[model samples]
Target: IDEFWDYDEADRLKAIEISHAYRKSRGRSRR
Candidate 1:
């Protein structure tokens, strides 16, 4: 159960990072 929890946490963080990167790219394009 602990391993699953860790996996989920990592996945969530990775998803957030990807979203952040995408947002930054879009903002840069506006310039």
Candidate 2:
């Protein structure tokens, strides 16, 4: 139970980090 929740949370955080990186790269490309 706890391990499952932790895994889910880590996945969510990883998604957010990926999106942030994607946006940053997009902005750089727009330059």
Candidate 3:
């Protein structure tokens, strides 16, 4: 159970990081 929880947290962080990167790229393109 602990392992599963950790995996979920990692997945969420990865998703957030990807979204942040995507937004940054989009902002740069817009400018």
The lDDT for every candidate, in the order shown, is 0.98, 0.99, 1.00
Better model by lDDT: candidate 1 vs candidate 3: 3
Residues 1-31 of candidate 1 have per-residue lDDT tens digits of: 9999999999999999999999999999987
| Best model per lDDT | 3
TM-score, structure 3 vs. true: 0.91
Decide which is better by TM-score, 1 or 2.
Answer: 2
Estimate the TM-score of every prediction: 0.85, 0.88, 0.91
Rank candidates, TM-score, best first: 3, 2, 1
Model 2 lDDT tens row, 1-31: 9999999999999999999999999999998
Report the poorest 10 consecutive residues by lDDT, candidate 2: 22-31
Q: State the lDDT of candidate 3 residue by residue for 1-31, as single tens digits.
A: 9999999999999999999999999999999
Candidate 2's TM-score reads 0.88
lDDT of predicted model 3: 1.00
Q: Clashing residue pairs, candidate 1?
A: none
